[model samples]
Target: MPSHPNYSNQGNKFAPAKTSLREAGDLYGQKEFHIYQNAIEKMRAHDDQLPSLPIITLEIRKATSNPNVNLNHLSSLIAKDPSLTAILMKHASSVFYRTADKPKNLQDVIKRLGMGAIESLTLSHSIKSLFVLRNHQLKALYKQAWQRQTLKACMSYHLAKTLHFPNPEDAIVASLLSEVGTLALLSSLQDYAAPAAPTYKILCQHYSKHLGAILLAKWGVSPVFVDVLRKTGAWTLDTGRLLQLVDVINLGLFHTIHYLQPQNDLIPLQEIAAFKKLNPQYAMIKQQKLLIIEENISHILQLQKNFE
Candidate 1:
């Protein structure tokens, strides 16, 4: 038996656990495995260094919670960060903002995006900056994780549309932010001496979702999104045909990796319980997986460009 390789950076949590050759065909939860216990213990040491919830994000979330809240004050807070303000400007002009009445200024962008879109994009741009690590090797690893997340986001959006999900944007945000725990774990271990990549991955599997939940709660991300984030690690956890954000991302993520690995065979959609629950025929997914991923790749990147 060969060792199961965790897909570098994509962090596809849904596949069957990869067993080491020594433990071939055996099953073990990486999170509960004892080998990486010491590495997992190190995760909490740098909570203080984890990025603080950006103030503008908080203000916007607060405003969203209160119907009577002053929109001007919320817009003012966002405008304080010129970079964020610029991102909003670009988004307001995007096709996602397909209004005959184009936004003329920051206030218009605010009105155009509303509380939900604003919150998603603000946190996406603001919080991701916190992933920076002084260690060059760790920094490169973090970049791969972050890029994988963008693709996941796109896939979630497309999957939601295919499945007729009520709110695709929420699914996209949940997918993108689900990897925060992995990012935090990498940051925590960046300075750890001589970490074997396998050991590092074990620690990641054990703790990434939990860390993501903590960061999202601290950042004031809505619990709906947080619940979806927490559920990503349970790749096979399905709740019937009533598809939610978690299911959307799980299916999207599985296909995203399949698209990326054109030369190799992927786990069939028929065998994946998550894909089966969506009511698409096994043959339908096999036929359309590439187009689903490739089409959404352009759409998702275009959305990111709007924020860029």
Candidate 2:
């Protein structure tokens, strides 16, 4: 297990809370850990339906050393899936790309945006397209999930540039797919009846443990991404510069939403602290940066509408 330089000595205080959440036992008075163990067993039995996509282990293996393969080859791979191609074209014509004219075809769009951006677009679209959940409740859940993911994708690109990460584009792709395990679980909720109007926190707490491991196994996601998702909530001096940027972007979006609508969920104070620590200049740069990113994302969404 290759650990990030900043991850050392960061004790897992959240681990115990995770235990209690998973166990559904006395939570406070359980003499032994067996009650919690039994609860985990039951949850495991219910969590059988993983994402239906085949594991692209070959892609993962190739990605580490030579991520910059030929664009035509990459485009061909993405074009095999119509939904993903639509998503890529939409993103390419989006405000992020800033082309004067909308692209007329997938090849044109891929040529315009370049391979790095295409990679992120393909990964984001593929995960969303893979697990089709049709229930009204599940649809709402996925909508929120997509919103969070889109926000993260925008923020990751901005943060990567700010932190001077080696591959800002790759950072965006990583951020986009960071919570895929959640999607895998949500895809299978039809198999069980979950309570209505679930909070993001509750849903994550309920399924993260098992789902995280399962997604890593089934999707062939890189170990680096898995590690980042596992420790996303933690704050430390060494949480990797790129991950720190991710944390700040997530917090910035939360605060931005909260300020716009007071009724929105309260932003965590620790998140604010982490954001401030990671980017001391965030206060100075946020408004302009956010405007640019949101405009791009909106453009992408608009393009998607035109296609529909």
Candidate 3:
């Protein structure tokens, strides 16, 4: 039989031996686990200074609720952070929106682009800055990871819009932040390595429950958004159309990054199946999903180069 190009002949060095979910739970139950708990607690205790500029949360809520919110106010808020303001300007000129004649000022950028576009650009900028890698290898790993995240954000945004959701911008923001817990854990855990590490997989598997609890206690993420991310695995559309879209986008993006194969002995098929059933649109386009993933990766890499 011809060997599959995508399959590696190397034995699964990253795989963990058979362990029941209950056993995994017991691992966390050990006394040593409190080390991580304490670390998370300490990190959370530090006040999360709002980045030098206003975040998307403030801009979106004001724009959506108050039609009278002017471009000047939004512009001034963004201008407070030079880095974010630069990102917004670059995005405004990117081919994605076809504003090649780059807007001269924040007000021009806001007036020319709708709130949704501005919000997405802001989200991309914010997420890119959250985690910084010191080593080249880890830097590449995080670059790829962020590419996957950006794709998820784009897919979620489009999915919500297609589903006629009221707050597609919020969905984009949620999808962008959903994996923040995972990033947080990776950033704090010095022993963890990336690209191919069983420990990394284990960390991700437990992150939702672990980080969700920590974020709830430490970060003041809205209770509603937290609930949406926590219940995402259950396929609960009742949370609202935007969240449902976020759930499916996350599933698709994750499977794409993992090559639709189980990693470190973690079987993600069930999660993928649940998401497909809940969002039939993702299922129907499964064949073309890889194309979207590749395009997103290419785009993000280009963006990263510009920043460097």
Candidate 4:
């Protein structure tokens, strides 16, 4: 299993709480350990407060699941949420899908984007609501979190489509929900004093994957997604099989950190187990893989912005 340079030392799998706190103390300063500890305790104690998928999103999914579902009915369901309707309109007109004639209305937008893209976009829109925060500092963190996740979703969608995956929406959902644990933590911090940025980041690195898995399980998401969240950042994680949604997310994260976001502690693409597995499956050279992302970046950014 490949380990992240920053996160590998915490060990694979969720650590026992007491053990995690001790490791937190060691990795972060003692001053911030208590803060991380209390936050975790609060999150666990208030586990029921973790956000649920919106009723409307559930309705949309239930409706979309029908083989003979009505597009007009789907459009009406989405129109109930005006903001979501606006987002759909904007996305349809975005350069990624810009035909000579733009989609004229919600129904047309739905037809243009297709059921898979609509479902992914609706889920992505619903998930963003969970990241809204009142804490001034946490607000910035949440914004960054949203942006990173959106970037992941964009990259994941394109990669899945390029690799000829059966359902690219699965990759979109995985990328969108990857940092849900971080949102779970930030959501719990409404009345609490926000920790310093560095401490808050350390807290997320240590706790998000575990908490996200728990929340997704509680919300009854697919086991595949729950597993993906739990194993996030396990870069060398080879399932010793064909490419999976986890590989899509791993590749997305690599692009986000190394290329899109450009972090300091960069890891080479060759070192990633997912890249090694996925790269050849597409039969593209290293530069070509990056080129795929580079070519679609503006479109991805447009989708990300419209998603907001």
Candidate 5:
């Protein structure tokens, strides 16, 4: 069994609350673990079937990596997907991306937004498309996961803004991809004849980080985002170095879990090394207050409505 970097010894006084998961692993004997490994191998063999961005998007991603890639080349790729074309045009004309006049076509959108914003939008949609699972039984599961992720993304956005982080959208993107590992794992099990087994869920937790990075790489997601997948769930990491994005993600997870299950024993914010670096007073965000019971219930609703 491939083990993740032990997240427990953050050198903090509090022990990591991975006991439930670790205990779950213990409950699954060697035979159960092998069943998952075999299923995972079966899924990996049919890699092409895994949901991903259209080839055009992947091509644009590769082309954009070249600093000197021509803008016309990008336009050509964007024109290939009508769905992508419509989405880019609609968003490019929205209040945020709109120029003085509405852009008429894909070429106009690229020119107006520039390659950086265009790339992010493309990657965002590309990654999100994977969440539209083919398995109908998983619809309820996807909805629960998507809603939770949206909440975390919203928390990350406000946290980044409050901390004066330059890119709040990074936090949102990170939040969405945070569950990639589990999602990828479950999708691989779509053809596994067994019911959604307990050991499969446990295995997803164990190997999610590694599997997530692979999926992101396949989609040509930026390395920074790949790094985000690795570290956001790490509670005890030195927040001083990766203070803004990484710390905001940790905070987002904490609050999202706290909202979902008020009594969850995942690390307290005050005790977390990342939150400690913040002023803790939340002085920057005077207007927006979270509720003690619901704990940002309105924010959760707003995020679901916006992202859904």
Candidate 6:
């Protein structure tokens, strides 16, 4: 069969190649397949130059993990990073918080956000630095990917809060980290130059979970969070009798995809097993899921404006 042409960045845009569609796909796939594998192998061998978790992020994670987290100390740490402090203040004053008054200062922002949301926001603010690249096209691709992940993370957090899930913040962290593999794979592609968009996406879908799980484990992330990487797009996922963070992550992923590609042929939310589990506990989700999504979409756009 005649296949779509995979254009090389260096070549004429309309130049035809002798390669068949299947051949082109296989060639691109094989090349990226190797790159993805190499990236994973390097991570496994602990010799990769992939970005390490930021120290401020680590400190925030440690502080928040404690039940007795000191808001004053935590605010002080975040205040040390002026940009982060600004992001937090902007987020606290955002319409999503529904606060009657704007935060007076960093400590007020920290108090309004709470430790869990603070952790998620802190990590989200710093995640972009992890995937920086000199390749312009690849860099744009990574930026889009990062933005989508951030939106998904916000969607997860909102979904959890809407459903009254116990640890909504966990949903945010899990959803954000779900794309760790994709970012890492894209970073690896910097040296390989840009692959056709479809090829890179295929590589991400096929191998991101494995690579992400490996990287998160190495970073000392909780297994519960690491498992979110494994179950990200599992539409049929059923995790025990109760709704869990992974279920929220799955639902968030579904909504994020639907929001980005409304015409996509994804399974309807009512039909998905995750939504089914949530339906029994929160019937309002079935009725207001779209509204919930609409609100999250608005919030995501606002966040991009603030942080971008």
Query: Whose TM-score is greatest here?
Result: 4
Identify the candidate with maximal lDDT.
4
> Per model, how many backbone clashes are there?
0, 1, 0, 1, 0, 1
* Regions of model 4 farther than 4 Å from truth: 1-32, 260-263, 279-289
Q: Tell me model 6's lDDT, rounded to 2 decimals.
A: 0.68
Listed in order, each prediction's TM-score against the native is: 0.77, 0.65, 0.61, 0.84, 0.70, 0.82
Candidate 4, clashing residue pairs? Answer: 2-236
**Per-residue alpha-carbon lDDT of model 3 for 1-308, expressed as tens digits?**
11111111111322234445676577557655555545544544552521222355456545634667777677777777788777667756655445557688888777665776676566546656766656565566465556555555555554455555676656655665565555555455433334234334444564434553464445455565565465544432344433354465455444334542334333344434434444454344343343334445455344434333
Q: What is the lDDT of candidate 3?
A: 0.51
* Per-residue lDDT over 102-170 for candidate 4, one digit per residue giving the tens place of the 0 to 100 score: 887888998888887788778878888865678887687677667667777778877888888887868
C-alpha RMSD values across all candidates: 5.3, 7.6, 8.1, 5.2, 6.1, 6.3
Model 5 weakest lDDT span, ten residues long: 6-15
What lDDT score goes with residue 210 in model 3?
Answer: 50
Model 6 weakest lDDT span, ten residues long: 4-13
Candidate order, TM-score descending: 4, 6, 1, 5, 2, 3
- Which 10-residue window of candidate 3 scores lowest in summed lDDT? 1-10
TM-score of 4: 0.84
Off by over 4 Å in 5: 4-27, 30-34, 44-52, 59-117, 131-134, 193-197, 279-300
> Each model's C-alpha lDDT?
0.64, 0.50, 0.51, 0.71, 0.62, 0.68
lDDT of 2 by residue, 188-292 (tens): 554444433322233445554456556665666667666656655444335544445446544434433433343433344444444555444443434323343
Stretches of candidate 3 exceeding 4 Å from the true structure? 1-66, 99-102, 116-120, 131-144, 162-164, 190-196, 216-219, 222-224, 233-243, 258-283, 286-308
Candidate 2 steric clashes: 1
